[model samples]
Target: MDIRQYLDSTYLKTAQQAGLSDAENVEVVKAAVAEAIEENFKLIMIRPDMVAIAKQMINDAKSHVLVGTVIDFPEGKSPLEEKLAEAEKAIAEGADDLDFVIDYTAFKAGNIAEVKQQVVACTRLGRKHGKIVKWIIETAALDDHEIVQLSALIKNCVITHLCEDDYNHVFVKSSTGFYKTENGKPNGATVAAIKLMLENSFPLPVKASGGVRSYEEAVEMIQLGVKRIGTSSAKAIAAGEAASGGY
Candidate 1:
């Protein structure tokens, strides 16, 4: 993807290095994100815990970088109210975008109605705040049919409401860094799901995440039509430094 077109300088829980307290972790994340911006990163996805700090960092920076926050994070089982609260809080903290993890449990259990309801709630809330919402489907856990169904649902919600155009607002992301295949790669199912989103002309972008750590893989994802990316390896890629030992 050429690194800049679709990169969310991500700092998920899994991306945290070991042995740092929450405050220290926030500092580390801020430094990393600052570096990412200096290198021309377009987006920065910060954990909710780090939202306030991230916002401050972005404000102090000389360049403009889109700031985002994750809602319902790795596990999407939080109550709808909680998810909405998190989204609102993030927006209030100056996040320009919201990356919400869809309720994978409900979707996997075939509770289609509940799944849509949760996503719709977050999407509507994001709209109210004038913030872009990117639904993280955790596609690694979904079968092909479910992935297609989710894509269709997002399209319906966003298009029916006449939200912002594709490039300007909203997106469907593929994972939450919770699962990977046996080969230590991000589950292929997530990539497949993103591909489905692309083929269907969904009005939102697609963010590929979880286990994306190298330049080759990043380029491959962009080639696959991923418009956004969530990765902790942004600094290395920007510096043209390959992942240690070829990843």
Candidate 2:
């Protein structure tokens, strides 16, 4: 199926999370960027701090792999100004895509106005800078109804506040690949959740991320109408092997 084009090979672990020293963790990110270039994946998703290094590596290799970085990362609790500043820094560092974690906690808490403001401001910044923007809604942290509402919320915000052309550049991504669920539940993209996102966020595109570890799973998400699949197992999935990992 030539799945490489649909994959955003990702590595977002911090040194502490990976149980490695700072230098060792950077090595991990370097290896991932190297692998993405070698495998010809569509993009390499890394932390904001790693964006410049990854960009340098890709440029030196003369590869086409775009560099993507997370904004406010796995936690989307940052204030609006902070999120904007982080994203601006990432853009200056040569990131091609900006994946912002939407303030799902605030949304769940009924602070819809604040959430909308962040979405509009961040999406506008990305569009202005000519970067692809994706909003990570952290679906696992939300119920089914919240998923639909949040997806629709992003769509409406884009369509109403931004131009029609921005729809293609912005996406409603499924997760941050870091949410913890109760009772051992799946913490990433599920078919039902992806479906809800796709149905509600139509025309804006959906990215099924988190916990997608196999070729079969990636294909399933594609069939359900996702534009991209974010996973740490992109290489294995591309080879038609089942990958074992959390992200």
Candidate 3:
């Protein structure tokens, strides 16, 4: 497949977490988004704290950029109502899209009903507000069966809601930067989950995140059928930096 064409359709996220709060972190993120947008990127995702600043940047830019933010972010341990409220607030604040993490604990504990309920609640709010929702499955922590089961549930939800199959409504994503393997290599299980979603006909996109810090890795994921690439190192990779280098 043509990589550039796929890149044109993919959403690139400039993620900021509790770390990287240095004086230059925000500036770097802004510059990355600006550069990515200039390079023809269609979507940019930022943290809730940086949403206002990101909004200002997007407003001042000459190009059109879709802004997104994470709700209940890297962890989905937050209460269901709280997550929904956060999604509502993000949409109200000019966030065109919202990416929410699935409750890993709930899923691991076999509380599949609760996990599905949370995803449904958040997606419902997103739809009501005319905003797009990307359900982050956090694939790093799930086994093959769990991944398949969640994919099926998401597909069922999308069909029940009558949403488009390519609606960007739900995404199976990798790690949240918390866990890693013994060798420190970023796990690629999420890629497998994404393939599962595609094979199962889930009505959503797939986003690969966590240790994706290079253009080659980004392209690899894209070649594997991911439609979105989430990273804080977009600028570095676009500039041809190696994945091992700091963002």
Candidate 4:
């Protein structure tokens, strides 16, 4: 299969987490953008701050590779205004796709309305701007039942508030690859978790992120009906080598 088209070659790291200066972090993002261009990957997912430089580089290269960024990030506790402001800034910086982390904590607390509101607001912002928006539900933080329920919740919001044809403009993504799990549990995308998402969020598409390394794993996700795989190991997978979990 032409897996590059299904890959969102990604590198979303904070300056501190990566243990690098801000400038150094940009360098890493730049290198990833260069690699995406070389590999002809579908999109390059990076931090919002890197959007401008990545946009410039992608434009200069005259490449069709999309520039995407995270919103509300690993934590989805940001107020609506803050998330909207962050998303606007990224779009203005030339982002083509936005991955939004929904308020799962609220959902778990039985605040169904609040969770739906978050999805509606974020999806509306991205759709209005003609940008793709994927909701990161952070599967690691939830059990299977929560995954199905939330996935269905997101799909319902997308279908109800947005036109049915706008499904491709949005997605129900699996994880952030950053949520810590107790007892060393799987923190990213898993086959079972993804299967639950796919079953509930059909027609909305799905982006599998976190813990996916190597060609076999990536292919498995793709074959299971995911439209995208977010990984820092894109190059290794494409080279037919095992990923070192660089994501």
Candidate 5:
């Protein structure tokens, strides 16, 4: 299979997170953008701050790789206005996809209204601008039931409040690949979580992120109905080799 097209080649680390200087981190992001262009991956997922850089690089290269950026990132605790503001800036910076980290912690805290409000607002904001929107639930932090509930929640929010055309534009994504779980458990996408998402978020599509580090794993996620696979190891996975990376 042409696995590269299904991959969202990703690099979301900050300077401090990667233990590098700001300039050095930008260099790393530049390298990743170049690699995605060379490999012809579907998109390059990055932090919002790097959206302009990635967009400029891809445009200069005349490559078709789309630029995606995170909104609210690993922590989705930001207020709805803050999330929308970040997304607006990313869109202005030429981001093609806006992956917003859903307020999963709020959802877990029985703040369903907060979660639902942001989901609808963010999804509409991205879709209104013709940008793809993916809601990352940080699945590793939740139980199986929460995964299913949250997936259904997103699906319902789109279908109930948005137009039918928006359904295909919005996605229920699996993880951020940055969540730290107890006892070193897998902090990214798992078969169980993906299955729950797929089962609950049908017609809206699902993107499996995190913990998928090999070509086999990518293919497996596709086989299970994921429309996209986000990973830092997209290059190695495309080569059919096992990749070594935290994501």
Candidate 6:
């Protein structure tokens, strides 16, 4: 199934988060960019600060790989204005896609209007700049019911105001690959959760992210109608080997 085009080769760890020096972080982003180009992966998702370097590297190599950045990433509790500003900066720096962390906490707290508004505002910004907007619902932090509910909410919000052309650009991504959960608990995209999201978010595509680390898992995800697979293990997966380190 040509899973390479469905993969978003991702490396979103910051220097501080990875416990590496700043220079090393830059090198990491550069390496991921190079791998994406060589492997013919779908997109390169990096931190916003490193978007320019990734863009330059992909451009210098004359590759058409799309560059993407995360907005209010990992945590989705940021104020709407702050996320908007972050999106603007990423777009200005050549990010073709923006993975936004939506405030599902607010939604679970009965703040549906606030959550919907945030989605509306962020999608508008992406549409205005002609960039794809993917909302990370952090499914690991929610139960099956919550996942289904949130997927429906995002679908409804995008359809109500966003143009038809932009509908395909907007997606319901499963995780940030960074959310924390209880000990011995799964903290990223899982097949059952992804299936639930796919079953619920009609027309709006789904991206299965996080713990997917092999060719088999990726193919399984593709079979479930997942439009994209987000993983740091994209290189190893494509090579038909297991990725040792977790994302």
- Estimated TM-score for each candidate: 0.87, 0.99, 0.81, 0.98, 0.99, 0.98
lDDT of 5 by residue, 91-177 (tens): 999999999999899999999998999999998899889999999999988999999899999999999999988888899999999
Clashing pairs in 2: none
Flag the better candidate by lDDT, 2 or 3.
Answer: 2
With a 3 Å backbone cut-off (N, CA, C), the pairs that clash in candidate 3 are none
Give the better candidate number (1 or 2) by TM-score. Answer: 2
For 22-135, candidate 3 gives per-residue lDDT tens digits of 566777667756765676555677676666666678788765767778788666899898998887777767887787878877888988789878877778788777776777
lDDT of 5 at 117: 93
Write one digit per residue (lDDT tens) for candidate 1, span 1-247: 2577466777766334446776777677878678767877887877787778777877877668888888987778998999998888888888888988888788788787887788777788887777878888777777777788887787776776654553347788778776555656455224566688776536577778766677777777788877777777777766656555211
For model 2, give the 10-residue run with minimal summed lDDT.
238-247
Give per-model CA RMSD: 2.9, 0.7, 3.7, 0.8, 0.7, 0.9
Candidate 6 lDDT, tens digit per residue, 105-147? 8988989999999999999999999998999999988989999
Please list the C-alpha lDDT of all candidates, in the order they appear. 0.74, 0.95, 0.66, 0.92, 0.94, 0.91
After TM-score superposition, the amount by which residue 161's alpha carbon in candidate 3 deviates from its true location, in angstroms, is 3.1
- Model 5 is weakest, by summed lDDT over 10 consecutive residues, at 238-247
Per-residue error for 188 in candidate 5, Å, reads 0.4
The local distance difference test score of model 2 is: 0.95
